[model samples]
Target chain A: MLTDSDSRNISIRAFRIDGRDNVATLLDPAAPGDRLKLLGDTELSAAPASPAGNEPCPEETPAPVLAALEPIPAGHKIALRDIESGEDIIKYGVVIGRAAAPIRRGHLVHIPLIRSLYDERSGHLDPETGKPKDISYE
Target chain B: MNNKTLSWPAYPRKDGRKGIRNILLIVYTVKCAEFVARKIAASFDCPDVQVTGFDGCTDNQYAVNLLISLIRHPNVGAVLTVGLGCEYVQAKWLSDIAAAEDKPSKSICIQDAGGTGASVREGISWCRGTLEFLSSAQTVPMTFSELVVGAECGGSDYTSGLAGNVVAGRFFDRLVDAGGTAIFEEIVEAIGLKSLLVQRAATPAAAAQLADVYDKMLDYCRSVGQYSISPGNFAGGLSTIEEKSMGAVIKSGSRPIQGVIKVSQKPPGKGLWLLDSTPDPHPVQFGITNPNDSEGLTALTSAGAHIVFLVTGRGSVVGSAVAPCIKITGNSSTFGRMSEDIDFNASEVLDGTCSMAQLTDRLVNVVIETASGKLTKAEKLGHFESWVPYKYQDTGSAGTRRCEGTE
Candidate 1:
């Protein structure tokens, strides 16, 4: 049973679709130092401490919380754990892309930082506009 | 599971099909007749009068079959076919098919009618009289069991999988449970999930069919060196085609897929169906499949969908010709920005203000309202965008006969 205060703190700011997922999706625009509560895959709620205070945690956690490392837009991915460079970025329990550089826990996971395995052009896109930088029809 | 009683007033057709709209469809046989057809439709200034047709002068069996299906669509009360006299796809042949279906139809050739002006004048006259005649057509009560709904997603973002498609999936489950039919297309979008798709087949035969379609689509993508993904999908936080596929397939719900039906082929005793618009395997691949969102919607409309759902996480402003498209977006901001074009906002589920079931119930209410003569935003705004591209697909024994040229 959750206390009223604990229940009040249970805001779903991000969602993890599968248990093996290394990334979660942000439901709202998040800024640095903002703590986001995770939803979905309740089995993974008991993993461990999420890179914060070292005090002994409660046995039954309301929801796992993570701190944002940067300004991430809504509907974007956030790393649930520290992902090494060239490692697979897992979401929906499947490999969506490979990390181009070492990504810290709670850091934003997106294009240029991550490259698609099938399409090499995924990494060669303009960061601001998300369009291919080298292609021209004319 | 709510067991809500769903029913609507429908324009009953001679073939025992029920329609939510009584439209006077204008068919242009070739590009030459397009201007006259548009003028005739615009002269009425009524949403019920709409234009759709093939632009090719050359013979393509696929295009002819698609046109025939549109003419026989239950929503179209009457049809008027316009041609440029020399086109292989004769307007008279199309009008004859419509007449055979017990619909009042007419055909006018631009060359035979003396010019574009004469053709437009005659088409407008026929439309005016047909609209008046269809106004008095009796409507009967239609139940949920009689409904066939199709779903397609476009301009997808991360919220599409988490919220938009999830709500649609839950609604599809409910609709299927209530004994209604549901269809979802874009097999090319279901990349890296062949086994999952095959596992959801309702029958062993359907499972085999799904496996074959999946393999063919994968090969087609490889041969063309292009998956169905786009830069907008990447901008929207989708990393790869696999991630997008995982999200796109959720709109099919958990219902066992009945079987794979070709484009323009109606579902054979449907609960849930997968429409394969991909070209048949050939030594040489020709046209692109589902080049745009409107093409996908038009394919679904040709498959006898009484109502179609267009789920857009980023937002879209398109509707189909025969079926009223209900646009839905899961991104609340996108919905806010495009509220006039988007119909339902599934972001309530993401905001924790409502559960998925609650959102699905609300979506069901929207569907029922749209089916009960409520004009969708697209219909109100007159956004009946349709596309009929020349594509090659094996038109199996699905009742669409090969065109043997106009008599």
Candidate 2:
């Protein structure tokens, strides 16, 4: 999962999909020139002219990054950002669905709905140490 | 194992097989004659009998294989296949398979009966007789080793590898220790672990057979131009096929891979196994087609499993027709999202709330109870989704040949 420092680790503009994705979609409306910070540390210069191949973000502009990405098609999951179709989808840092479609820099991905029965998270804190509680809900 | 005693009311069978329920089944040869199949089952209460779907094709070998396996399931006391007469799959073939097991079966075609109405009436009469025969069956005391348990993890997340699978693995180890059979399938996930698996073989021949099964699966996946690392596993935080495999393979517990089996073959002895599910990989958008966990469970049941221990991370609303699928959930969030579908939640292992041994013991008791006749979430909800075999375009032209130069 590690890479060389010379390789700039960019933040997903709303999300940068792969480290090597050609372009990133804009979550917020940006003027011709906007200074953006990268996620991982490798320095790179943004093109003066917005890179070509910018499609309209799935959602309206002026929204926060992750929020701005719109839902993709049903049963077809999209790349979180720009990613190759063969690459895995990393949500909550786990595999839920595979990338069924190629993602643009900012195109939203949709997760197929499988009927799940449980959704509760542990909130029990250890009374003695005040640490998060470990408990079996059912 | 001593802390608790699992119990349930089971139907004792003539072959010494134990069943949680006795069901008269109305099977169909094709989608075309589904109406006749339903009419046969509709004459009785749902509890007494139910209709299960399986389309028999003229040339789909896998479909024929599945139908034959399903018809002989211990849960099915008697069966009747409704054929449309002109279809490729013959009623006689199906009946012969069922009859070979000494199970009562009949086939009626709409064309032979003069029409759908007459066929339905004939089917209903046959089913009624089957139901009467099933009702006379009794419960027999079957030993633990008489059961062949199948393990599967789907809708997986991190906990799937960490806990859900581990729990199943523990059960698998215990099942083997107790002299029962256990099967772990979806061979694509067993990649990279072959060395470790081969090490578990009881004999050299078994080890070589295990390696061959892995080779076939590896070859099949490479030929289809499909990556063995499912996009779902990658999205779920698994990095490589190996990482996904490490998690997926844990479901077999630490039992030896006794003998490799094909989708249609039953496990011949007690121990671990890898079933070849490498028929064909469906495209990512649609996900690969697999037998409903229940259908696979039924195959294991026909192979002689009395019950199944199912584990899930993503969670599914699923149940089996013959063996009860006692689902254990692994993902903390998903366990919360689908509590109803889950019978046991091992998500605590992720948070360190519960030790692995503690969860394993809990799961073992659940299996015992399920075998004794407890209804699983899927069984209760009536989720009977089964899949047909995957079909390739050319049915094995040179295009489907295994690649030469890849691992």
Candidate 3:
């Protein structure tokens, strides 16, 4: 992380809240045209495995940023890597919730993809409306 | 932030309390007189003068205590009381308390003054003279120990847990190291954080006290049927009550748990203390009210906090009454959208433009500046919200103490 290449002209599209997190928070909208830095050798796009014939293929050349699939707002999570269904959505080194659906890299990981185990209502927020309801004792 | 290096500007009252800001407080004892009091305070259009009142006609224990505690707050240099004349909680009692403390105070009854217009005029006239007189209170140097800083996080998000509170935690660590009192509240957010907090207790007794707070908060939530975790939290990247609890306590850093204090009760000793704002932890209670952000912030002030650090991930433009709220946001987008309302950006820490330590430095500088009387963005924007909770606890069998004593 202290390497020159890590800090050199990297566009911070999102932040991985912790080293253990499978998702990262976008600092800027990751629109279809925007390119984002994928920290810690986490590839924004994992290349097709060099045709099975090329055994011990040349060392993996790392790509720093990848093009976003859609517009993802700042503060919203984008999958750092592919997350399987029921996998814990980790942030801040703790499991905040679990993914209810499969999440691909650059895909938004929010209410639509994740459901909260804490409350009956999904993830405390209405993703589309952005209106917040209180965590009621009711 | 060394107090030795920085001399905080303050009003050295004869009451032995150092006030960061000397303002004339106009309080309305009931809803009927609130308009007059609001008019009087609004007439000043000065940051030094603020308006707050109890909207209840019948005297509730919590309302009376909140009024009394706010009136006696260290930041108030003088006060003027406005009454509808028939309210159960008399404005005269509020005026008398301020007078007893040697604070210049006056009282006006709307019924006797003939009408609302006259009352507002009378209150306004008295406040003008009082604000002018109190404006000259002697200045004094304040030490860190005399400072009470409150930590609160609202409109939370992923960055709130990772950046905002972490920055505040580092600041709180330094504040406690310098022997100042630091309070982080909202036990309603601490449901699943007991294990994380218990280890930080300075003593076994303190650990029990910390555990008791968790139990009580959980109980209160169960009885009321709601936890503190809200939909906004999920929208901002928080999931569960336990997760929110874990994030919230991070603002207190590794400070050892001091005993818990309740709403309107000052911390008995310095260091880190929890201001439990829920109704008495007794089994029989009215259950806790679902408090808004301002209610929670005002509750923190009632615990003697002179400065409030409110961290928002979703963005809030509010500054509660009595104290100047320093708004901080860990979300870069939110900061961009609400930069004028927000004072500091912890989102830079998340974006990696700065490290957590650097963020802490920024926060400390803002705190020092605010303590020295620099108005926060919220204060400048005039977003003052204050209210007393209608929460009631059974005083029949349990002691009247809402926040259990350190003993």
Q: Model 1's CAPRI class?
A: acceptable
Better model by TM-score, 1 or 2? 1
Question: Fnat of each prediction?
Answer: 0.37, 0.00, 0.27
What are the candidates' individual DockQ scores?
Answer: 0.25, 0.02, 0.16
Kindly list the per-residue Cα lDDT of model 2 for residues B7-68, writing each as its tens digit.
Answer: 34566554555566676666777888888777766666454466665564454666676667
| Model 3 lDDT, residue B14, Cα | 65
Tens-digit lDDT track for model 3 on B30-130? 99988888888888888888889988787788778888888899998898899999989888989999999889998898999999888888887888788
Task: Output the TM-score of candidate 1.
Answer: 0.88
Best by TM-score: 1
Tens-digit per-residue lDDT, B22-72, candidate 1? 999999999989999999999887789999999989968778889999999
Candidate 1 Cα misplacement greater than 4 A, ranges? A1-12, A18-20, A40-63, A83-90, A93-104, A111-138, B1-5, B283-287, B397-407
lDDT of 2 by residue, A10-122 (tens): 22232232233332323223222222222211111111111112332222122122322443221122233465664444321223234444655434443222110111111
lDDT of 3 at B274: 82
Quote each prediction's TM-score: 0.88, 0.67, 0.82
Clashing pairs for predicted structure model 3, backbone only = A124-B231, A136-B226, A137-B225, A137-B226, A138-B225
